[model samples]
Target: MRALRALRPVQEPPARVTRITVHRPSPPLDGLVELIWAADSYVAQAERERVLPSGAQSLVVHLGNGPLRVFTDEDAIDATEVSGAIVCGARVTPLLIDTALGPTVGVEFKPGGARPFFDLPADAITGRVVSLDALWGASAHSLRERLMETSSPRDRVRLLEDNLLRRLARSFELDAALRLSLDAFEGRDLTSVGEVNRRTGLSPKRLLALFRDEVGLSPKAFWRVRRFRSALRALDHGTLRGAAVAAEHGYFDQAHFVREFRSLAGSTPREYLAARVVGTDHVSVRR
Candidate 1:
């Protein structure tokens, strides 16, 4: 038998490091959390990271580095840097973030995941970013202090999960309601809001209320993100023909898809695909 050759683990470069890490939450969080994750990058120059909407809200801690500048579709003039920890509201428009600030670690809550924990309605913060302290009060400030004491990324993540787990709301059917609302969205099985209400056995007003309080974006808006995400995926995979992609995804026509795509993505499908960074959700920026 030939001597086995030893294989060395491939190491990612240390300097100018860019990375994304996702951690699995224990037990009960599995249902509500899509994944608890962090996005980190270190480089001399600023990176324009285009964060697309997927109908999820992010609970972010800047990790003592950033004040990431954020711009929206409206102003394109004024930019805001979120301080300490921030909660990003669910949005339909693409968010332009300047990542020159520093590394960030945060949790991207699954749609409807935020409602159970916060007494405030999810819609209250839609299309906005508010400090964690505003929602979690003293605990948010304390968590920041604890996280700063640890240099290890792993420790920071654990600290975040621990704090949130301690604050998990008492078990209830809130999860069930959220699940039913989302189920109608799975695979575009339900066509419209009325269809979701009918399938979920929730009336129009009740479903609307639940979505406003639990999911931030209403069922209609949430589905738009879902649909947009799907189209982006297809386009990224070299769909080539925008028309075919639209038709397959249930868009009324090529024009319809283009309009909707630009509405959420801030660019035509073709333009976006042209600028995308391969294998990642983010688009490429000129250095």
Candidate 2:
């Protein structure tokens, strides 16, 4: 899902655009899904956009003209079209999105929280986008149809939540150790992976295994993503230059920060800030 912030639209969207709505799920569903959002934008001003990783995975069901197409590389070559209802896995690299607009309703899964929704281990699809049909078969198509048939955003969110609750896969459970690890690693900038292992009383190898099984990324890797997010937050809300931001986020120095940010976000801090689409992690760019 998009970050939790008030959006100032960079430009007026086309007349057909639906106002973006973000809704949080209730109770048990809230534990897994961070937020459900719906929006309609039939045309994109840019040919392609680079979406930075949010660490969490998301399931998006298209309700408009076409399915989402993402490019694997910066050149915008070799684009692959995913299903209308697809699950995007936790990733470290930027997603090169073809901004051909598709009205979409999406669910953002919390860290290690998507395990109960899919039969396979979370790590199985890390850094990749997989169709829900591949996991749920005909049920996925049915769910999308129902979503498309619903006009109200509220009804659509409720329908999606009820479907997820019913479709909960029992194959994997988020054990206590894994839960504790996520708690320790997520948003705790000062907490080291070693510290988390110590707190959980698990060896590094064993802990990493748990993280991969449930969280789709190693604890250190997840922490790195979270740190990048924190840096982004700081940059978004505060006036911090690269060196200051780097220091704030525990990088060795500005150079170290630049390298890591480039790896994860595909841009230097300044460039990313300059290109960022207000109210979103997407960096606007042409093909």
Candidate 3:
């Protein structure tokens, strides 16, 4: 199995549009791709914005004091008024322009990373955007205030993780089937869909449906993102050559990798890596 590692952001100056502060409780789950902490201080335009590439899903927790408007490529939604904390569930790549007031703090958990807590069938949650207040049966605002009051970042993260796990446990089982499947996909060559189905005892259709419900994308799509993340981490750590990384991760060739990377990451892998080297981090929303 491949050892899990952290991808540190380049410590350059912050970008002009947004400011982010991140906290990590521990190294991310092995099959999980990425995790991020982000905050914005002002409202953004309603114009379409590509927040993340295809295949990945995100969860957004609002720590602001104003309402947030979430717009997909085709629709606009007035999310809960930001008085407290709200957790947006998994979603495919879509335009997420923040049409709300500033001081928005949220965490973005990547595809595999989010799967541990949210392993449900996509149909169970189709077209439903839930407020954390509704899900927690309390005002999100109060919960967030309590969380923010904790001074220690580590403590805060542990608290957040505990809350998330508790909430999700009410809906899904946290057991070996999901954990082992995640571990099987890490670092080794990509496994076939049939093999995954056999090991997990879920039909391919059922597996994809469940993944989408909780994680917000199909299993095959999730696998691609996981592989992409693996290559990106290698690039970040300077541990693999470009071609070697591409071939090892199951890309047909370097061009195939580049095309897939650009489609999902909104830029070529090299360009994205270059930007990361300069401290332009990525942001994603979870509606």
- Which structure among the candidates has the greatest TM-score? 2
Q: What clash pairs does model 2 have? A: none
lDDT of 2 by residue, 1-287 (tens): 35354232223356223355677777677777788776644344477878788777888888776768888887857789975788888899988887776667788888888878887888899999899999889989999999888987667877887887777633334688887877777543665789888888999999989888888888888989989988888888877877999887889899998999999988888888777776666786744
Cα RMSD for candidate 3?
Answer: 6.4
Which pairs of residues have clashing backbones in candidate 3?
Answer: 32-113, 53-264, 84-141, 85-140, 121-210, 121-213, 122-213
TM-score of 2: 0.90
Ten-residue stretch with the least lDDT total in model 1: 1-10
What lDDT would each prediction earn against the true structure?
A: 0.70, 0.78, 0.51
> Candidate 2 at 73: error in angstroms?
0.8
Model 1 misplacement above 4 A? 1-16, 44-47, 169-173, 238-241, 277-281, 284-287
Error in Å for residue 96 of model 3: 3.4
Supply the global lDDT for candidate 2: 0.78
Best by lDDT: 2
For candidate 1, lDDT tens digit of each residue in 137-202? 998878878877766666666777877777785443355766877877867545677888777788
TM-score of each: 0.85, 0.90, 0.63
lDDT of 3 by residue, 184-217 (tens): 5564565576677777787777776656665565
Residue 266 displacement (Å), model 1: 0.8
Clashing pairs in 1: none
